[model samples]
Target: MSSLKLKRFIKDSFPDNNLIIVSNREPYLHNKSGSNIKVEMPAGGLTSAMDEALRSTGGTWVAWGSGSEDKNNVDDNDRVAVPPGKPSYTLKR
Candidate 1:
C-alpha cells in the first residue's frame, strides 16, 4: 500500500490510540565505536520492514536493548526516542 493509504488506514483504524509494537529484535542498535557511540540497524528483512512501518507512523516499539552501549543512551525510564536526532517514537528497552 501507499504511504497515504497506510496513514489513512491507521487514522481510521486506531484513532486516538498509540500504536505499540513489541518485538525481540531492536530496530536501532547503539554500539561502542571507539570513544563515540554509533547506531546501526540490524541486518534482517523483518527488521527492515518493521523499521519502515515505525518510521512512517509514530508509535512505541518495545524491544530488548541488545547493543554494546544500549544502557548508556536511555533516559531514567529506560526509554529512548528512536531514529536518533529527529525522533518520531519511543523505544522502550
Candidate 2:
C-alpha cells in the first residue's frame, strides 16, 4: 500500500518532467473573523523542506488555505480535488 502511494507521488511529482504539489495544507494561512485577522504558522520539517526544495527548483506547491475550511472541496479556479486532510500534488504546466 505504501509503495503504491509512493509510486503515485513520484508520478505526480515528475509527470512530464514537472514538479507540482497539490495538498490540503498551504504553506501559510490567514484567519479572518469579522474585522480581525490572524496568520497561522506553516507546516514543519518535511513540509517546510519540500516548500524550499520546490522553490529552489522552480517547482510548484499546491496547498489549502493552510487553514481554510473549504480546503476539502474542489477549487473551481484550479479544478483540484483535495481531501479534508490530504492534498494532491501534480506537475505544473
Candidate 3:
C-alpha cells in the first residue's frame, strides 16, 4: 500500500538516507480482551527485507486505547509518538 509506493519511489529516486517505517500497530497479537490488547510483532519477511535494505533502520510502534490518553514509558531518540493533538507525524531524512 502506502509503504510499497513509498519504497518504490525512494528506491528509484533517492537511495541514500536510510529508511525507517513506524506504524501504529505491529503485525501480530499477543492478547486481546475486554477492549485491552497486547502485541508481539515479529521480524517478518517484509520487515526484515526492509530493514536489510536500509543502511540504518529502526521503527517505533505504539499501543493505545480508543478513549484513553497515552501513558508512554519508552523514550527513544529516534522513536516518536502520535499523541492526541497530532494523530500522525511523518519525517524524512
lDDT for each candidate structure:
0.86, 0.49, 0.38
Clashing residue pairs in all predictions, respectively, total 0, 5, 0
Give the clash count for model 1. 0
Model 2, position 8: C-alpha lDDT score: 68
Model 2 TM-score, all chains together: 0.43
Per-model TM against the reference: 0.90, 0.43, 0.27
Q: Lowest-lDDT window of 10 residues in candidate 3?
A: 65-74
* Rank order (by TM-score, best first): 1, 2, 3
lDDT per residue, candidate 1, 1-93, as tens digits?
776677677778999987788999999999999999999999999887766666778898999999999999999998999898889888999
Give one digit per residue, the lDDT tens place, for model 3 in 1-93: 355665576666656653455544332333454666443334678644443333222232333322221123223442333322332332211
Q: Model 3's lDDT to the true fold?
A: 0.38
Clashing pairs in 2: 21-62, 22-88, 22-89, 23-87, 24-87
Point out the higher-scoring one by lDDT: 2 or 3: 2
Q: Give the candidate number with the greatest lDDT.
A: 1
Candidate 1 accuracy as TM-score = 0.90
